[model samples]
Target: MAQRSPLDLPEGDPFGPDNLPYGVFTTSDAPHLRKIGVRYGAHVLDAGAAAATAASPHAELLGASSLNPLMAAGRPVWQAVRAELRDWLTNPAHRHAIEPLMHPLTTLALHLPIEVADYVDFFASEHHASNAGKIFRPDGDALTPNWKHMPIGYHGRAGTVLVSGSPIVRPHGQRLPPAEAPASPAPASAAPTPAAPSPSASSAPPRPVFGPSLRLDFEAEVAFVVGAPSPLNTPLPLAGFHDHVFGVCLLNDWSARDIQSWEYRPLGPFLGKSFATSLAAWITPLDALAAARTAPPARDVPPLPYLDDAAAEPGGFDLRIEVAVNGHTVSRPPFSAMYWTAAQQLAHLTVNGASLRTGDVFASGTVSGPRPDELGCLLELTWGGRDPLHLPHGTRTFLEDGDEVTLTAWAPGPDGVRIGMGEVTGHVVPAAS
Candidate 1:
């Protein structure tokens, strides 16, 4: 069936002609092999066939099961593929041959777009940082001394990067009990032995526990993917950020507050964060986000010389990110409100001459706004477990077993149009025995 006219799409069609994102997919007919495709109205166009029909040399590159080959081809090939993909969807002459190649998203499965070479998560949001300082260390100043000087980030575990819809097993780790709670918690796996009936035996306090995390949480964030590689000792200037970065997507850096607070005191995140990180499949090219760019929030302290270049334009994206738990809307974080821009983060990352690989993935720290409801995670929204959030089902201090969390986002396009970032969702199940 050929598309007779301009395809009549839904009111808020995510894959309209203007927003053609790329990802790997597998259909019911071809479950064994994966193929790359560009998104359209409720359908995915075979990028390989589209490239072949356009008589482009990149056709063979697009036929690969992964986007890494095309990504390594750099700016020129990426631009050409984007142009050809848009033409195939809009050009009426190619309708009949192309229609058969397109597959509905409902009948297909989307996988991770790029095989991540490395992973990093940053603490770039001042609002989020301020809240943390106040909640954890109310006596000292909220802003740390060197926080304004540069972007703060740490390397994360890339081996555990999972695609959307994957089950997130509730991680079990050692955690400290609250001050007011029992002195010690019984072992999770061991059955409690009966103590003496004497008064002293009954009054003895319990010991610390090892069980599933009591304060599991979710962080709503945005991350950028590196398509163009850079050599060691060759820093990426702020002006050349777009040249190195291929595109942006949504990320969920799941957290366990109890494990983090106890372990992050001397260093940074460990088992608390490395257990799992979720990402959306589609990779929205930077060129398609022209209208979504905006200026970074006002800076109280100017950045270092190499991190900010005056010639480079303001570069924050106007993407609205949302977090939902079990189908109920809880927090709506404004991605545009981030204090540090993606370019600044990219420049700071490589300022020390760290070379970038083809599929390096780094995330913007949790996005939070000035409003109370703008908080990105339960730790902030509930004031470090001081205030419990009241939901339709019940009140929640932290994520409970069986709760599912999802992160989704959208950006502005031309003529009142909007583009979407495919959602990343994961369900929390019981921890290991």
Candidate 2:
């Protein structure tokens, strides 16, 4: 009896022919050389070598060490390459030629697929926003006044975006001191307590002390990668979303909450958010997620003409996400529950004539649902530390130095199959002295 081929994936395999997510990898023999790889079951297909062996015209694009060259070739090229790849894997005649190019996943070292040009993270989940407001500002309204009108986002540090499996060094910054407790009243029978020293007029305002962050957190998010570049002063409309976006990847925007609270006053996030961001190695193309598309939640407030997506195709993806800490499943947040769609976020991002560049990443911030167990971040899960999450190992309010956080998701595929979005994971380490 002949052994079964690796390409003959068993039924229900998430990385089947239908889900050929792309990545960059290096083999052990030649560690310095990187090649574009496609995930097929438990193996990584050497896409560049396969393209060359088939005498394909897109060989140069596939041969590049990074995905930027292929991505910048635009949608038509992207579609053509994807179709060709599917044919190569499915056609029996090419099996012998392709089988030799496949390598076991364990033997490859994966790297960040794209050269990140810019990054923008948005506050798009109503449930997450509401929970955060209730925890931090109990006396104020849960939702911000402008949240319903448009997607609120901030520019992030592109240089710090990291590949999955990278160690996260705890960041250091200023944090406000814990509030002082009032002195106990003296008993009437005892000597009166000496008068407490009063603050002088020249006393400086409360100074923030510097140290390692006490509130380290992880945000489970889904991000889209841009494929084509737009000219300066040209805004990408909502309809052009598919034309520019190449695919989606899981992202962990590691945050220092205490630092954020101290410095995010009038100017928004600075050192708190700029430290590091982790991204999955694989990128599932948008074309493969056709079955996952669904209508976004109905809007309470109508959007402006440019941002309006009422008549457009369904923009929300029905991806189900699971977050795990130390291998224990902690939360299952649904991506479909997001109030704002990625299309709307992209439109709003470029509404002011900002151009779209290839490799730009925009993430849907902290996907949380309406249930207690569906919260996305520790800030919400622990409710500002008033509540603690109990696990087999111990209880946790925020991340510790050795904790590992992993995020994984799957979207509905054709004929009841599931499309897996490979995980983004990071292990925390002590702050550098």
Candidate 3:
């Protein structure tokens, strides 16, 4: 595995022989069918097909359309298959038999790799959290009272989880009307903008208006796919993060800011967040990302005993996450700036005696850094819409219709090697009336 092998992958390509990220793909020739495939440079090895002809017992797991069955088998099976694939692709003795199973990746279609059992999103980046507080709650502390003590998160709608190329429908919902609007509203032709505010304004609260969201936004995030399930009343310690987390992928947690602000007073987000989420196709195993591991930023407040393990394992990834809207690069947020680690989030998710099922997805919320240019979402970058973001083609206070947002990431693989986490991209369409 160390030296260059028989595979024709470019030396510097992220998906080289040493990095065989797995995904579910199908060629145009067999559009209706999907088979498990492992990437090797520009090609995808039909693992299921290779296993069948190679007389490997793991063929059934490798050949399956989805990775769920293999995930449930736990770590040993995952390690074994990875080793086998590496050997089969590199060994001279096996190349002749494995060549026919490899297909150019460009000719295939990638689909959702697993059935999402649950989805949790965490506000783990201190920079992002601080900016959110300053922008959304100017009078309150940047970090909440309980924020440092726990990894704050909310359960997102798992059913709305979509694959990479899915279309994002701009959500329609209720927003508070201006406090200065007259008691009697004029017709659309008569008046489009709200009437000029009188010197003396009403003390009453504004009424709610229903329509498409005016403040649609995107959050660039990194999500991990849980590989195995944990029993009820049991918790996974910090040390078991990589053990239970099979792999990582790019995630775009789409949001409707106006709708979310109106509804998230007592309880957390519901429709504003539940509409849709996008994920990348490939799940690059955590094992393949050994070179990316690094020590996370020093914590300002130590967490409780259950979630704290300073001497444990490396907790941060050196991944560079970039956000693109309509082919314009908006930000390059730093994932390593996160104040909380994936281990902590996993521990807190199950600390309440909740069970974790295979395919559970959890994301490290918007990975904004300390710099203004490092902001991860429009809410932060635009400073709650007070300042508009200047783009190459145009300006955006928030996302406009036809805006295509994409999130992509890369991390240090093995020494000088780099691995691609793939991209989760979606185009925004006008909201349905």
Candidate 4:
């Protein structure tokens, strides 16, 4: 693919590597759902207004132009908008017509690009899985028998997913009793050594009660947006998985380890994970990312034949993902550590003939690694806070109020400019009374 020239970058360069993700934003001058546009560098391509002035028939659809309505229209409309926008941004003649609507990218705040119907999280990273497993079940086994066979995942609360900048409330829930509340001192002994009280009679502090948790934490992962829809009985093949994917974004899956440990026994994560998940404001289209696609490292134990694609399509992305807390960089690694590919994740979702919706979402669970610093969540990072992480901000075992967490990603391609996924940021909030 040809890279965008630096000259083109000055005038809202849509092809710039850092601004690859497609998003919808509006200016204060024309504010309404009917007025929306895609961004590039310093420009905002007003799709709805431009199409209206040009007397284009599709102008009506573009009219109710925010991403919410566009997304409701499904894959057909998404492609239509992308195709038209691509031509206008890339051509000189259309550039003049669209330039009038260009607004500073820094001026607008982002809204949830799509109306999510359901959200699912997957254990896609091998390093993360192994690291997490070692924390959960240390000794020998790193994976459950079913893990190597398929992409394991759980359904998440779609309503809890929020856009960037939303304040994360401190979650209130049950916690283990604080280390026996420093057992009461025994009565002064008459002699050097006195008889000890009976174990049962020896009163100890009452067991801890259900209340707000103090051990709150954050989880960093990648999320993919579903553009197309598949019927309930349909089965999507691994070889053709990309057809269903619309784009990708950075996600922060917030967690309350104490609540999880107590509730996630037979069933998977519930209130612990269902509270809040933050996503970047913009959505990076799959087409814009074509140049950054690459194959992942070979799998160990050889995946089952049903899950194997044998390199039919790119199984990995060149994107370099990073995570930070309170302005401190945590992970500066690549996305290649994922054991299962997105195609496999989607294929597994539909193997049972389950239906998928256009606004559905899936998160790659805790993209941790061998090193302690590379761990995605505090649970594994601090070994349950038996050890606390010393950060530039200060020492922390888990997130505290006013703590800010941010996620950034970029891919350096043969094309001179780098393509980047913006960022998602949020600060912890005190629990509601």
The estimated TM-scores of all candidates read 0.91, 0.94, 0.92, 0.85
* Best candidate (score: TM-score): 2
Task: Please estimate how well model 2 matches the true structure, expressed as its whole-model Cα lDDT.
Answer: 0.88
Give the per-residue lDDT digits (tens) of candidate 2, residues 149-214: 888888999999999999999999988766521111111000112233456899655568899998
Q: In angstroms, how far off is 48's CA in candidate 3?
A: 0.5
Per-candidate alpha-carbon RMSD to the true structure: 6.5, 7.3, 6.3, 8.4
TM-score of candidate 4 versus the correct structure, residues matched by position: 0.85
C-alpha lDDT (0 to 100) for residue 54 of candidate 1:
71
Kindly report which residue stretches of model 2 are placed more than 4 angstroms away from their true locations once superposed. 180-204
Q: For model 1, how does the per-residue alpha-carbon lDDT over 59-130 read when each residue is reduced to its tens digit?
A: 988898888888888988888888877777777787776777888788898888889999989888888888
Ranking by TM-score: 2, 3, 1, 4
- Model 2, total clashes: 0
Clashing pairs in 3: 48-63
Which candidate do you rate higher for lDDT, 1 or 3? 3
lDDT of each: 0.81, 0.88, 0.82, 0.70
Name the better of 2 and 3 by lDDT. 2
- Cα lDDT tens digits for candidate 3, 111-163: 99898999999888888877776654556577667778888888888999999
lDDT over C-alpha atoms for residue 272 of model 4: 76
RMSD score of candidate 3 (Å): 6.3
Model 2: lDDT of residue 78: 95
> Which regions in candidate 4 have their CA more than 4 angstroms from the true location?
1-20, 29-35, 65-80, 180-208, 370-373
